[model samples]
Target: MIALPFAKSGSQSFLRGDRVHLRAPVGGDYKAWAALRAESRAFLTPWEPLWNEDDLERGAFRLRIRRYQEEAQSGTGYPFFVFRNSDSRLLGGITLGNIRRGVAQCGQIGYWCGVPFAGQGYMTEAIGLVIPFAFEQLRLHRLEAACIPHNKRSTRLLEKAGFQREGLLRSYLKINGLWQDHLLYSLIENDRRSTTNNKGAR
Candidate 1:
């Protein structure tokens, strides 16, 4: 596993495009991240796993900090917060998790966007940057993403980022306290190469 401190050092680094920026989460960001969740509870709850009432408590921020730190250290995950470059507003977050180094050579993608920022293509850009990092920096061979079938937005984002629809998974995830069906998507290294080649051809 990569050293945690080494990973944490990357939090200060960022990826930038004309409209979006992706960077590691900072301690000061807890307030904003938590507030977005608090305000978007209703908009997001139905699509998310059960959240403890205490999940947003001020003191709980420490736990999140620790979790992020551990994730960085172990290389099991890299969590990033998305921002709009124009105004530096936090739009949402995406994570590359469950990273396995050996034969698996894969990781899963997960994300959430604030209700107000739902349709601006920020998440898609974030995923685009992260997937390359997963493949190039992390040396992962494949990446997987799953979304509730009802989440057409997420499905679209995955597709736009070059993931192929793999299939449906029944009772695959627990959302808002209920086991639900999900659609899986994946991208292999070859798929990325093909995409780049196709873009060049066009």
Candidate 2:
């Protein structure tokens, strides 16, 4: 991917953590993004919805970028590409979608890591960065995530990042071309704050 551009004032638009940074995807990211996803197809397919044959094509990617930009601009959702801070390598992606305002200030969080990057702490760190962005910048009250019961890695990642397992949903989503059950998890703003406070009190 091309180097991310900065504003003339030099403020960073991307969310930065110790090991990774989250940035909006650009047109140039198509190549690297496609390659990474293609390489990790088997690893990711099971947890994700079935992919169309043209899913990795540039046209489809461009459409994705456009939709993400629109969503971000409209405060409906925020999409980010996860990159390693040391080398700026694209590792995966995370998104806060289905944002609801007014009476319900909540959004759904989803993420994936490349096969090669799996088992590392990259995804956990990425979630840490996104939570602050969702709760602080977006002023959201709660973030929800769901994972297949069999996806132990994802379940562990969510739990490690402080999400509470709420329950299980039967045939909750269509993943890998079939309806699958998911374990629901959520992190509320007050819960997060309490956790932080408790840690600081230690």
Candidate 3:
């Protein structure tokens, strides 16, 4: 059986490399999250789904928190807020959603990092930390990720994190008020062994 690490209290938390860390989002984060997301609006909108008018509202945040709590209780999703380890500044978020257990044991991964933190390795490091947690701890057998074709930064980050390009998914996602074509990527547990062996040699 695969060894798995379960989150304590809420979804499990971890430091992403020495530079970044991830923890559950709290009520206090609503302000910081809203500000950063606002600043990065133009930068993020193209690849992200259309935001609801009430998205940043305190009531919306409360509802979101409740939903995340229930999802955590049911083992359906794990959401985490990313931060800079040195200052604990909110950078963005990562989530393992659409989880399926049983023989498949799979989930889909999604993420976003604030504009100021973009182009740095923060997102990549966050993904690296989370994928292992999903595979080793959550006992998820396969992981899937999708990115808009024009999202070069996101595609590159996923590649760096060891996900393989699987196929093109026509109109696979709705973003910025329109349907968008996406490239799908996947990583399976079997690939982990070869990857581990290669890393051991380096």
| Backbone clash count for every predicted candidate, in the order shown | 1, 0, 2
lDDT of 3 by residue, 97-170 (tens): 88998888999999998899999888888998888888878889899999998889989998988899999999
Off-target runs (Cα >4 Å) in candidate 1 are: 2-12
**What are the root-mean-square deviations of the candidates from the true structure over C-alphas?**
2.2, 3.9, 3.1
lDDT of 1 by residue, 39-148 (tens): 88898888899998789876687787778778888889988788888887888888888888888999999999999988888788888888888888888999999999
Best by lDDT: 2
In model 3, which range of ten residues has the least summed lDDT? 1-10
- Please report the TM-score between candidate 1 and the true structure: 0.92
Name the TM-score of candidate 3.
0.91
- Number of the top TM-score candidate: 2
- Where is model 3 more than 4 Å wrong at Cα? 1-16
Q: What is the TM-score of each candidate against the true structure?
A: 0.92, 0.94, 0.91
Measure candidate 1: CA RMSD: 2.2
Ten-residue region with minimum lDDT total, candidate 2: 1-10
lDDT of each: 0.83, 0.89, 0.84
TM-score of 2: 0.94
